[model samples]
Structure formats: C-alpha cells, structure tokens
Target chain A: MRSSVIIFPGSNCDRDMDVALKKFGFKNQMVWHNDQSIPKSDLIVLPGGFSYGDYLRCGSIASKSKIIKSVIDFANSGGLVLGICNGFQILTETGLLNGILQQNKFLNFICSNVYVKVKDKQNKYFKDLKKDLLELHIAHNEGNYFCSDDELKSLEDNSQIAVTYCGVDGTENEKTNPNGAIKNIAGIFNKNKNILGMMPHPERMIDKYLSGEDGSLFFKNILDNFK
Target chain B: MKIKVIVTLKNGVLDPQGKAIQQTLNGMNFGNVEDVRQGKYFEIEVKEKDEKKAKSLVDDMCKKLLANLVIEDYKIV
Candidate 1:
C-alpha cells in the first residue's frame, strides 16, 4: 500500500508516521505543506506537532496552508485521510471533522498513555481490529473536544464517533477523561467515515520496546483492510 | 481607517484560562469577582478611507480567520 504524510513547518511526528507506515508495509512519502499537489496514494496523514507555533489557535494556521486544499479535495473524493494529534486539530479547523479541540479543562498540557475504546468498527480505519480498546499516547494542551448539542446528537445517531477515552477494562467515565473532551471523545469520523481525526498519536506507540504495540495493531488493520 | 475587533468564546463554552485567572484573583482576595473570560482583540489599519468599508472588511476577516464561528464570537467595535 502507499501513503503520504504531510509535513507542516513544525510537524514533529511526520518522520515517526513515515517510519510506522513503512514498518506496516506501506510505501510512505513525505509531502511538504507548501506543495500544491500530493503524490497519488492510498492514505494521507496529518501528523502531530505544533504547526505554525500553534498560532491563532492550534492547527488553525496550518489548516489554511497551500497543501491543505489538495488534502481537502482528496477527502471530498472519499479518499482515506487520518489526522493525529495536531493533525486532528487541523482537520477540525478545516471543517473536515466536527467540533473544536479546546484547551484542556484543567489548564495544563497533558502527556500520557491513554486507553481508547473503539466505538465503531464499520470504518476502514478500525474495521476488523481484534481489540475493542487500544492504549495510545496523547500529548497536547488543547485536546478538549467541544461541539454543539445538535451536532453531537447527529454524530451519535450516525455512529460517527470512532473512539473514546476509556479505562483498560473498557469502562469510560470521568476518571479516564484526561483532557475533558466532550463525552470522552478521543477521535471521530466524518459522516462518510473516510476521514478520521483523533488526539492520540498512534505513530508514537508503534514499537513495543519503545512504547506499546496497540499502534501496530492500528496500522496493520488499515493495511489489511486496504489489501 | 482603523478597525477594532474583539473575539471571545461564546456563552456556555468552557474557558480554562479564564477560570485560572478567576481563581488567582480570588486567591488575591478580589472576592467580588463573579467570573472571568478571556478574549482576543485586533486592530487593523486598512487603506480605505470609508469607515463603513473598513469595518466591513474587518468583519469579513473576523468571520473567515480571526474567529471560529463554532466556538467564538467576533464583534467589530
């Protein structure tokens, strides 16, 4: 399979995503934010980092970058696009996903391993995954997810909610809500399920010795589904 | 003409920075402080001499870039 990881000015995780994608048998290319066109690929990633110094708002500036137009077009065409961490923030800013990732409710940057329950497996991102919950790494200050009540209702009704924060036993509650995301939403899919935006960094957790293997499961599942 | 604008989080939206400032003020014994909210202020000097046109341009800027309509409200002052 082929993949492309878009690199914004300050994207710190693009290399890690490239490594992870290649490790999972994907031929991954790094695409710069200023480029007008992206190489044809099966998947495109907006990796984690403080793009544009998190200016104006996290991911707000990067969302308007030159390359984003192509990214949005790709998504509109039903191509698979994944946004991780700062990438997730950019997706929301671009209106590709619902809601805004506000600052954490506690007014602090949180960096830790979090358990995320896969809310639905109907999408290509998580379909056929063996586990209902995966432990992933979250590092951000603005990870609090907020949306209008009506939007939330629609998302729930459509099963657009892809993953939510939860405990290891798959229990979801306040204790597991690290950043005060609404309803513990850790990630979500667009109505078509071709686009996914999430706060966790699966690229950061692809190695068992360095971190954990849940990310490996995530990458492997996507490649298998594509094949 | 110079256009001035203020952008603030909409009512009912959580403002953690504002909350922290409120707590800090309370700790400093400013007990009368009911609540606090943070916002952004921008002043743009447009070459257009017409006040109405300048204000309209700034309004457009706010709607498109300065403020995210989903979570923030912008007012041309």
Candidate 2:
C-alpha cells in the first residue's frame, strides 16, 4: 500500500508515521504542507504535533495550509484520510470531521498509554479486526472532544463513533476518561467512514521493544484492509 | 475602520483556564469573585470605508477562522 504523510511547519510526527507505514510494508512519502498537490497514494495522514505553534487554536492555521485543499478533496471523494492527535484537530478545523478538541479538563498536557474500545467495526479501518480493545498512547493538551447534542445524536445513530477511552478490563466511565472528552470519545469517523480522526498515536507503539505491539496490529490491520 | 471582535466560549462550554483563574482570585482574598470566563479579543483594520462593510467582513472572518462555532461565539463591537 502507498501512504502520504503531510508535514506541516511544526509537525513532529511525520517521520514517525512514515517509519511506521514503511515498516508495515507501505510505500510512504512525506509531503510538505505548502505543496499544492500530494503524490498518488492509498492513504493520506496528518500526523501529530503543535502545528503553527498551536497559535489561534490547535490545527486552525494548519488546516488552511496550501495542501489542505487537496486533502479535503481526497477525503470528499471517499479516499482514506487519517489524522492522529494534532492531525485530528486539523480534521475538525477543516470540517471534515465533527466536533472540536478542547483543552484537557484539568488544563494539563497528558502523555500516557490509554486503552481505547473499538466502538464500531463496520468501517474499513477496523472491519474484521481481531481485538475489540486496543492499548494506545495519547499525548495532548487539547484532546477533550466536544460536539453539539444534535450532532452527537447523528453520530451515534450512524455509528460514526470509532473508538473511546476505556479501562484495561473494558470498563468505561468517568474514572477512565483522561481528558473529559464528551462520552470519553477518543476517536470518530466521518459519515462515510473514509476519514478518521483520533487523539491517540499508533505510530508511537509500533515497536514491541520500545513501546508495544498493539500499534503493529493497527498498522497491519490497515494494510490488510487495503489488500 | 478598526473592527473590534470578541470571541468567547458559548454558554455551557467548560472553560478550564477561566475556572482556574477564578479559583486563584478567590484564594488571593477576593471572596466575592464571581465566575470567570476567558475570551479572545481582536482589532481588525479593514480597508473598507463603510462601517457596515468593515463589520460584515470581520464577521465573515470570525465565522471562517476566528471562532469555532461548535463551542464559541464571536461578537463584533
């Protein structure tokens, strides 16, 4: 599979995402944010980092970058687009995904491993996946997701909710919620499910020695789905 | 014209920074301190000569970029 990771001015995870995609047998290319067009690829990724120094708002400036139009066009056409952490913020800013990520409830940057429950597996991202619960790493200050009540209802009705924060034994409640996101939502999908935006970093967990192999399952699963 | 705009979190949206500031003020002996809600202000210098035109342009800016309508409201003053 071929993947393109867009690198904004302050994007720090583009290389890591490239490495992870390459490790999982994907031909990955790093695309600059100012570029007008992206190379042909099966997947497009907006990696995590404080884009434009998280200026006015997280991902707000980066969402208006030159290449974002192409990204939006790709997603509108049912192409696979994935945004992780700050990338997720950009997705919402671009209106490709629902809701906005607010500051953490305690106003602190949280960097730790979190368990996320797969909410819906009918999409291409998680279809036929072996595990229902996956341990992933989440690191961000504005990861608290919020949306209007009407929007939330539509998401729930359409199974647009992709994953949510949970406990090791699959218990989900206030105690397990790290950033006070609405409904402990860690990730969500567009109505078409072609676009996915989440606050977790799967690239950071691709290695078992350094982190864990659950991220491997994630990457390998996508490659499998692509095939 | 210099159009002044204020962007604030909509009612019912949690403002952690504002809450912290409120608590800090209370701890510093301001016992009657009420709730605090943080907001952003911007002064936009528009080339448009008409006041209404300038404000309308700024309103577009607020909707497009300044404030996220999902949780914030932008007011032109």
Candidate 3:
C-alpha cells in the first residue's frame, strides 16, 4: 500500500507519520502543503503540529492553504483521509468533519497517554481490529470537541462516532474525559466513514520501547482492511 | 473605507479564557464582574467608495474566513 503525508509549515509530526506508515509496510511520500497535487496513494495524512502557528484559531489558516482544495476534493470522492491532532482541527475547519475542537476546558495543554475505545468497527480505519481499546498519545491545547446538539444527534444515530476517550477498563465517564471533549469523543468519521479526524497521535505510539505498540495495531489494521 | 468587525463565541459556548480573566479580576477585588466572554476584533480597509459596498465585502469576509459560523458570530460595524 502507498500513503501520502501532507506537510504544512510547523507540522512537527509529518516525518513521524511517514515513518509509521512505512513501518506498517506502506510506501509513503511526503507532500508539501504548497503543492497543488498529491501522488496517487491509498491514504493521506494530515499530521499533528501547530500549523500556521495556530493562527486565527488552531488549524483555521492552514485549512485554507493551497493544498487543502485538493485534499477536500479527494475526501469528497470517498478517498481515505486521516487527520491527527492539528490535522483533526484542520479537517473540522474545512467543514469535512463535524464540530470544532475548542481549547481545553481547563485552559491548559495536555500531553499524556490516553485510552480510546473504538466506538465502531464498521469503518476501514478500525474494522476487524482485535483490540477494542487502544492506548494512544494525545498532545494538544485545543483538543476539547464541541458540536451543535442536532449534529451530535445525527452523528450518534449514524454511528459516525469512531472512538471515544475511556478508562483503561473501557469505562467512559467524566474521569476519563481528559480535554472535555463532548461525549468523550476522541475521534469521529464522516458519514461515509472514509474520512477520520481524531485528536490522538497513533504515530507517536508505534514503538513498544519508545512508547507502546497499540499504535502499531492501528496502522496495521488500516493496511489489512485495505487489502 | 475601513470596516470594523467583532467575532465572539455564540451564546452557550464555553469561553475558558474569558472565565480565567473574570476569575483574575475577581481575585483583584473586582467582585462586581458578573461574567466575561472573550472575542476578536478586526478592521478591514476596502477600496470601495460606497459604505454599503465596503460593509458588504467585509460581511462576506467574516462569513467566509474571519469567523467560523459553527462556533462564532461576526458583526460588522
């Protein structure tokens, strides 16, 4: 499989995502944010980092970058696009995903390992995965997720919610809510499930020695599902 | 013509920064502060001679790029 990782200015995690994708047997290419076209690939990633210095709201400016038009077109045609951390913020800003990732409710940046419960396995991103709960790394100040009540209802009704923050034992509640995301939503899928936007950084957790191996499972699952 | 605009979080949206500022003021003995909400202001200079046209262009800017309609409201002044 092949993948492309879009690199925006200040995208600190672009190389990490490229590494993770390659480690999972994907031939990966790095695409610059200024490029108007992407090489044909099975997956495209918007990696984590403070794009455009998080100016005019996190991911807001980068969402309007030249490359974003192509990205939006790719997603609208059912292409698989994954937005992690700042990438998730960009996806919401682009109107490809529901809701906005507001600043942390407590007004602080949070960097820690978090347990995320896979809410649905019907999508290619998490389908047929063995683990129900994955340990992932989350680092961000604007990770709190908020949406209109009506949109939330539609998401729940359609099972568009992909993963949610949860306890290690898979229990979800206020204590498990790290950044005050609504309903503990750590990630979500578009109505078609081809696009996923989430706050956690699976690329940071791909190695057991450095962190943990659950992220390995995440990457492998997508590759397997594609095949 | 210069167009002025303010973007604010809609009612019921959480404003953590505003809350923090309010708390700090209260701690400084400004107990009369009932509530506080943070917002952004922008001034755009448009070349149009007509005030209505300048304001209209700014209104489009607010809707398209200056504010996210989902979480913020923008007013042109």
Report lDDT (CA) for all predictions. 0.95, 0.95, 0.95
Q: Residues A107-200, candidate 2: write the lDDT tens digits.
A: 9999999999999998889988899999999989999999999999999999999999999998899999999999999999999999999999
Off by over 4 Å in 3: none
lDDT of 1 by residue, A1-227 (tens): 88999999999999999999999899999999999999998899999999999999999999999999999999999999999999999999999999999999898899999999999999899989999999999999999999999999999999999999999999899999999999999999999999999999998888879998999999999999998
Task: Tell me the docking grade of candidate 3.
Answer: high
Query: What CAPRI grade goes to candidate 1?
Result: high
lDDT of 3 by residue, B5-72 (tens): 99999999999999999999999999999899999999898999999989988988888789999899
For candidate 3, lDDT tens digit of each residue in A181-206? 99999999999999999999999999
* TM-scores for all predictions: 0.99, 0.99, 0.99
What are the chain A TM-scores of the candidates, in order?
A: 0.99, 0.99, 0.99
Which residue pairs in model 3 clash with each other? none
Better of 2 and 3 by lDDT: 2
DockQ of each: 0.89, 0.97, 0.90
Index of the highest-DockQ prediction:
2
Candidate 1 wrong stretches, greater than 4 Å: none
Q: Specify the highest-lDDT model's number.
A: 2
Ordering by DockQ? 2, 3, 1
